[model samples]
Target: MYSTWPNLDTKTIHQQVLKWINERNNGLQSQN
Candidate 1:
């Protein structure tokens, strides 16, 4: 059903946020 769509989008966003955080945590310059 349509319920799965939100879950997919949230997961993608979560991963991006994690990556951005990791870059910051590592003190690496990023354009995110």
Candidate 2:
């Protein structure tokens, strides 16, 4: 995995994942 990923730090990756999840949740909430 490190070979494929190379340079991203864990904090950056975690923030991106959290942002993605929040966007998805907001979309779902808006749909309801």
Candidate 3:
């Protein structure tokens, strides 16, 4: 994937990882 403006992929990947972690945490919290 690519953005219209030039940018590093690390930032995008980091944001995605954060979102994934948040979703996982929510699911775990709901189960508890």
Candidate 4:
């Protein structure tokens, strides 16, 4: 995810982290 997302700016990194975290959360919820 982060590998493909361009994180050259501070805001982009923050958004990417949130995006990655959300995906991880969704995956965990599906397992339950």
Sorting all predicted structures by TM-score, with the top scorer first, yields 2, 4, 3, 1
- For candidate 1, give the lDDT of residue 6: 70
Which residue pairs collide, candidate 1? none
lDDT of each: 0.72, 0.83, 0.81, 0.83
- Model 3, 1-32: lDDT tens digits are 44643565868877878999999999999999
Estimate, for each residue in 1-32, the C-alpha lDDT of model 2 and write its tens digit.
Answer: 43455688777777888999999999999999
Per-residue alpha-carbon lDDT of candidate 1 for residues 1-32, written as tens digits (9 for 90 to 100): 43656756767777878999997977755543
Worst 10-residue lDDT window for candidate 4 reads: 1-10
Stretches of candidate 4 exceeding 4 Å from the true structure = 1-7
* Poorest 10 consecutive residues by lDDT, candidate 3: 1-10
lDDT of 4 by residue, 1-32 (tens): 45665646667888878999999999999999
The list of candidate 1 runs beyond 4 A from truth reads 1-8, 28-32
Evaluated at residue 21, the lDDT of candidate 4 is 100
